[model samples]
Target: MDTRNITYFIAVFEHLHFTRAAELLGISQPTLSQQIRLLEAEVGMPLFDRIGKKVVATEAGRLLHQYGMKMLQAEMDAKNAIKELRSENRGTIRLAVLPSDLDFQLVPLFVDFKTRYPETSLQAFSTIFVREEVLAHKVDLGIGLSGSLDKRLVQVPLGSEPYELFVHSASELAKRQAITLEELTQHALVMYPKGYLGRDLVDNVCREQGFELNTVMEVGSASSLLQLVEAGIGATIQPKELLKQHPEWSHIVSIPIADPAPIRHLELTYYADRFISKAQQQLSESLIEFFKSRGVGEDLELRG
Candidate 1:
């Protein structure tokens, strides 16, 4: 029953001599014999056969040795796993990020992360609803477009850029290098649903500039919105970074919106209610550093 006694039994069983086993265990021979007797009594079986100075393990002793060894190994394994986690030498980080982050932000950092922490790994889910995912504890950290967040959440700004409008390459609007708020409003516009990232920024900017924010269609998914824009269904306003990432959108051409730009910020957000794991914190540092190295995000601060 007692693990210490089991250890003593193992030592005695292996040595087959009480004096030698006690010497190996750093205990007296009398103490070892008394503990072995107590262990046998608790198990209701004789663990050893004593014939004068000769000692050998009984059936019960051999069985206990097998099971006891297993228990000890399991405990060692648990301790080792916890130690690795505490040391940040190993663990998986559950993270969520917008689809746009995969291209310019997360991908490059992931390469460096893997190289630095080879024993660790990541579970990533990409979507437009990064905040919701983090709030629900579905992911440990999230990187997405910034907006008002719950008080329980903390956000670290990574980078930001002014909003831009993308149109079909064949559209007459694409002939110009840039567009104005008034000109973009003259045509039908594709937009994200209410509460979606960049939705408020575009709408507010349109109102501030005295242009009506006309929405010809509304969608929840970023991919679908981009597809509609590429097909020339309607023009759409999105962060400049998204446009930079997907140059393969051959059907799409973007025009910059001039001065006093309506901007969207990208950020790393986590729940302030929970402890930030080493892997998650490491990732945030890597992201901030990644952006800084590229001469972007200079004004951004690494959030505590």
Candidate 2:
């Protein structure tokens, strides 16, 4: 019945080892066992099957685990709401950032944020995409080369990350300042896997140019695609700003794709109806300001 007991139970169920779970929860094994016993008594069911050193959750335990997580998350959300009301400057920002922004933009902003509001905690999740995270309310904000999501979500356009041809030094495509989407199809390609926004954008443009892409290889991350391009395997496409960091990859040339210059809009997405705490608002403002300061004003647009 107790929330603390539920927390302890979930931790134990997750690890299926009392000692390991206790360590993770920063408590003693004996104390953890006592709490789990108390939880089992309250529920009137055996939560675990113990045989030798192995432990497994019983059917009841598995069901409780699912509900227990939802209860705990709701409790945490309530606590966060109260904390937000007490202090405008002190709180956490739950952000889910795409991998490219992790290095190019988010890290530096995080450094500055820590210095400015040392009391604030930043919970950052760096993933390939954040649309699902935002929709699930697991993250308060998300940044990516994407646009709108479900109708429940609202997006603030930051900028368009111009797609450029990333080619290895010896590749014939590296000789040009720009290549049309029509010309891009002539070479072999390394592209993002299907369903990824970047890959979708490239596919859309190539389709517009009246041909399917010659994607010889497919990769999940921008880094892998770039590495493959560097290895002279095939050309790939990525944001111009991300490519700017690796000048040493001078072996690679990033030329803008012309004739319907393909680009993905990088946007900040969040649930429109959710409460925007001061910490969240400030972080969003900081991102907008940072973009303007970096002279990306021409590319970035702040959505109302």
Model 2 C-alpha lDDT per residue in residues 1-304, reported as the tens digit of each score? 9789998998888789999999999999999999988888989999999999999999999999877866776777688788777766577789998876685556778989888878888998988668778865678898866654457777777766677888887987767878887776788889988888777887888787688887889988777888899899999888777777556676788887885877777678877766677778889888877766755534554453
TM-score of each: 0.62, 0.69
Choose the strongest candidate by lDDT: 2
The clash numbers for all candidates, in the given order, read: 0, 0
List pairs with backbone clashes in candidate 1: none
Instruction: State model 2's lDDT.
Output: 0.79
Local distance difference test, per candidate? 0.78, 0.79
Model 2 weakest lDDT span, ten residues long: 295-304
Model 2 TM-score? 0.69
User: lDDT score, residue 256, model 1?
Assistant: 92
Question: What C-alpha lDDT, on a 0 to 100 scale, does residue 200 get in candidate 1?
Answer: 74
> C-alpha displacement of 99 in model 1, angstroms?
4.7
